[model samples]
Target: MTSPRFVIIGAGLAGAKTAESLRAKGFNGQVTIVGDEEQLPYERPPLSKDYLVGNAARDSLYVHDAEWYSDQRVELRTGIRATRIDRTSRRVELSDGAGLGYDKLLLATGASPRLLPDTAGVHYLRRIEDSDRLKRLFTTAASLIVVGGGWIGLEAAAAARQAGLAATVVEALELPLLPALGRDVATVFADLHRQHGVDLRLGIQVEHVGNDGQGTRVRLADGSVLEADAVVAGIGAVPNTGLAEACGLRVDNGVVVDANLRTSDPDIFAAGDVASVYHPLLGRHLRVEHWASALKQPAAAAASMLDKDEAYDELPYFYTDQYDLGMEFLGTIDGHDRVVFRGDLPGREFIAFWLKNNRVRAGMNVNIWDVTGPIKALIRAGRPVHPDRLADPGIPLDQVATA
Candidate 1:
């Protein structure tokens, strides 16, 4: 009898962790990871944070040591792209004219950065090379103009400021992170960047981006002109769902999967940024593009592939470090009626809870540490609490749930 073969597409954090989980769970089956990049699987958070600012080393981005794959018997195929998924024969065709048969397959294809209409000279901070290029550009460039005011744009702007480059952020919305954190908490971030000498152009759109004789030229919708030594578009990302869509898998905002991370096909699964997983707790399909999903979703995906019947119920979580503010946001702010604040909001040390029907739906800890457990507990408990007690610093987070 032959051992079952497991093939994972996209050798990223999710893929690496899935392979690791399979080995840790006593699965001696054949495991193969396929990636388009020549380099080994690596994490991406530092690309815009410590890495862009030269605080972190290049080696720190890798998910594992080079020898780990060879030791674990996991076939790591770099510089190979999975072009086609033949569901009938249970085989995957590669870009290099190779096919691999698999008993089970996992799609960790992740996402690609959404590019602007004209990206000729624009820098995007998605890959390691992009980060490296931007870091080098920071030293030579005197000014940078970031085309979006989202997390990526803001972080890139912060990195430029830290590197002594004049940075400007242009956003179409009224405030940065307004859709994600709402205006109440989003105001804090706007102030933080302004305080750090970032020129924020909010409620404006970029009409055209082109290079002039001197440098990059940006024209805003309001007929304003801005020029900078370099430009970066940190607008957003779209899931890599072409393979899934072509193979007849359900693809909505991303590859649709159940609570177990199982796709439409029983033998195929998806995790990480590409998987629009059905959250049992939230009762909706959520496609998160943060590092937390890539870091943690693999365990449940591996379990499902092994037919263990485990479900991935972890809430959507993400964190960001910009200037002096470090924040961890757990849960979703989809349908929250109001945001309750605890601790000192002015001092940037507080926990903000998104409440629906007075029940804690989501929470964010800004410059506050060691409160994730209690916040998660409160969100899971689904109990109503008095707004006064929930906003009081004197009351412990655990006790506030009952109050």
Candidate 2:
């Protein structure tokens, strides 16, 4: 009998980690990674912050050095796209007319940045190439018009501000990050940017955009025009599930997977932004698009592929940085009743805890360091906490949580 060969599609963090996990678990089978991008798998969060600000070197972005791949004996097929998956034959067809057979398949195709209607000089920050282009643009571009108030948009605006370029942020909602962070918490970010001289326009939509003599012209729904040297749309991202959908796999928002990260077909699995996986803690299908999920899911998925009966049940976590503000959020904000503050909100150094039924459902640390462990503990404890103790900075979270 021969060992099964594992073939993974997409060469991002999830895909790279999948190969490493498979080997770490003592899987002596062949491992291959196929990716459309030419470069090796690399970290993405820094692309918006350090890389954009010219503080990090390009080599620092990669998940591993060139020698590691060869040392691990993992075959990397770069600059090649996987066109289709033939389930019955258990093989994947690539754009280069090559087909690779696999006993098990993992899809970590990730996601693509959502784009607006065609407009000249409009950019999106997603890939290394996108960052490289924007880096060049920032060298001489005087002003930037950023659409959407999401993390990416805010991060881009922060980078632009750091570069001494004028930045204007346009959000359709009443406040920035309204959908994700809610009103009370989003206000913190809104104030952070405004304090740094960001021209934030809220409660408006971009009706049309076109090239103008100034560089780019944007028309708002309320009949106003704003000109800038460049325009960037960080609205959102669409999961790359074309191959999964075309192959008759169950896809709802993303490739639907069970607790074990197995797709509709038992032989196929998915992770990262492309998978809507069942989370035991949440008791629901959650698709997280953060670097944390991408870095964590692959190990669980790889273990499951080897019939270890493991589950990817970790709580979803994400972090962001803007100007001087840095934040780390743990768990989901769904069904949270009210937010309780532990420190000084005015001082911009506090921890926000979202409570439901007097129990902590989620919590975020803004500009606070060395407190994530306690925050996660409180969330997992799931015991009712006194509001006064939770709000009082003198009462440590460890004491407030009922262990």
Candidate 3:
């Protein structure tokens, strides 16, 4: 019997994990991983937080050691980008004009950062090289003007504060992180930074960036200008879906995939940020950009590729290391109808629960991750809970949970 030939794209956490899962699932076929980045499949979460502070070194970024790849008998190709896919031939064309035929192909190309157009000294961090460049400039910069109050912007701002750089965050919206977290919850985080000496600029629009030779100047709609040693934009990211689009497959904001993470073509599949996957749990096509989602979704995609007796309906969860707090959140937040609080906001030890018709829809705990199991089960079962009991922090979360 002939073995299966598997080809995976974009060797980030998603691509790397899928290859490992293939081997873990007992498939010993020829697995080829093609990636654009020169470095091994590394974790991107640390690049913005610990990596900038000198706590996390480059060596620690690798998701799997070199030996693991060799042991798994996986063909790893780094520093190579896939140009297009020829679905008719079941082949992927590389930048250098070479082609690799595959019985199954997984698209895990993540996302690219959005930068301010035609602006000099404008930087966006998404790769290892971006981290290195930012770190060098951070050492000399005294003040920084950060555009965009999203996760990347705020995280980088936190790192700048640690490096003794005076940082100012400008958000066009009423509050930073508005679309992700509710406005009320965002206030607590805003206060956390303001107390830590960060200048929070909210509800203002940056018209343009005009340079005056010595440093960069950010012009605002209110006729106010902020001069700083450096200007960093942490705006947002667009998924890399061009490859999938060129192949004449279904492409929306991201590559559209079914519940099992399979693309329109049964032979092709997609995971990671580039995939607008149908999530059974949420009952919607969600494109999550979290690191945890990228790592876990790939395995599910691979499982379906191999025709495993399983479904890829995973509970969505993500967290961020902002300031000194470890913010952990679980379940979906969009469909949630009601919200319950377990603790006080000013106290810094609290959990916010999003309830959907009496059931816990989503929950977020600051510096708390131990009780995630019960919250996860409740969301899966769509169980209901009393408002009073859910609001009391004195009652343990696991007590209300059933097997």
Candidate 4:
């Protein structure tokens, strides 16, 4: 009998890691990875932070060395797109008029940045090329106008400030990251950027973006205009679910998957930004588009494909580095009512917790290192705690769980 064949779509971190996990788990069958990008599989976080600012080397972005695939007997098919999935025949149709039969399949198609309505003179930060273009613009540009005050926009603004460029951020919301971090915590970011000399235009919309003879021009809803050498739009991202939807694999906001990362079809699985996984702890489906999910979900997907059946119930995790502030957030604030902070909020060194009915739901550590384990423990504890004890700096995090 022929050995079982495994095929993975998308060649980002999740796809690369899934292939690595499969080999580690002793899947000696034929393995193939299909990606549309010409470059090797790489991580996306640095594209906005270190790589964007020229602090990180380009070679550092790749997941593994170029020779790793050949050494492991894994077929790395870059610059090829997976156009369709033939479920009945268990094959994947390629853009180059080729097909690969698979006993099991994994989709880690990731996501693309949402473009501005008028993208004539707008830039986005999703791929390496995008960051390279921004880096080149920063070297010569005198000013930058960033649209959408989300993480990507904020990080790019911070990079622009670092490059000595005048930066302005425009957001429709009252505060940046309001929906994700809530008002109290989001205020900290608003202040952080303002203190760094970023001209933030909040609760406002961009009327239009176009290029003039001098440079890029931005028209605001308030009948105001601003010109800059470049403009970047980091509004949000949409999952790459066209292949999944075409194959009828059940797609909601993304490809819906069970606790084990197994999609509607038993033979197909999904991970990374494209998978809306059911969280056992939250008791609902949560789709996370963060580095942590992309880095960690592949292991569970590999195990599920091998019939190991271990649930991927890890709490959502993400972190950011902007200017001098470094933060790590764990869990989600889905239904939290209030936030409690420990440490110095004014000094930007603190740990904030989101609680629902006195039970910890999420936590964020700002410039506070070596506390992620404790924060994760508190969220997983799922028990009520005294607000006073949680707020007290003298009390240990582990002890605060019962206090």
Model 4 bad stretches (over 4 Å):
none
lDDT of 1 by residue, 21-79 (tens): 99988899999999999889999999999999999998999999889999999999999
TM-score of 1: 0.99
Candidate scoring better on lDDT of 2 and 4: 4
Each prediction's Cα lDDT score?
Answer: 0.94, 0.93, 0.86, 0.95
For model 3, how does the per-residue alpha-carbon lDDT over 1-403 read when each residue is reduced to its tens digit? 7788999999999999999888889888999999999999999998889998778889899999888899999988999999989999999999877999999999999999886874787878899888888898888889988999998898899999999999999999989987777766777778877987889999998999877768999998899999998888988999999999999989998999998889999999999888898877777898888888888987788798798745567777788887787888887777666777788777777888887778888888887668788777767877668777877878777555433
RMSD of each: 0.9, 1.2, 1.9, 0.9
In candidate 4, where is summed lDDT lowest over 10 consecutive residues?
394-403
Best-to-worst lDDT order: 4, 1, 2, 3
Worst 10 residues of 1 by lDDT: 394-403
Per-residue error (Å), model 2, residue 227: 0.3
* Residue-by-residue lDDT tens digits, candidate 4, 1-403: 9999999999999999999999999999999999999999998899999999999998999999889999998899999999999999999999999999999999999999988889987999999999999999999999999999999999999999999999999999999999889999999999999999999999999999989757999999999998999999999999999999998989999999999999999999999999999999889999999999999999999999898978999999999999999999999987899999999999999999999999999999999999999999999989898877999989998888654
Per-candidate TM-score against the hidden true structure: 0.99, 0.98, 0.95, 0.99
Which has the better lDDT: candidate 3, or candidate 4? Answer: 4
Clashing pairs in 2: none
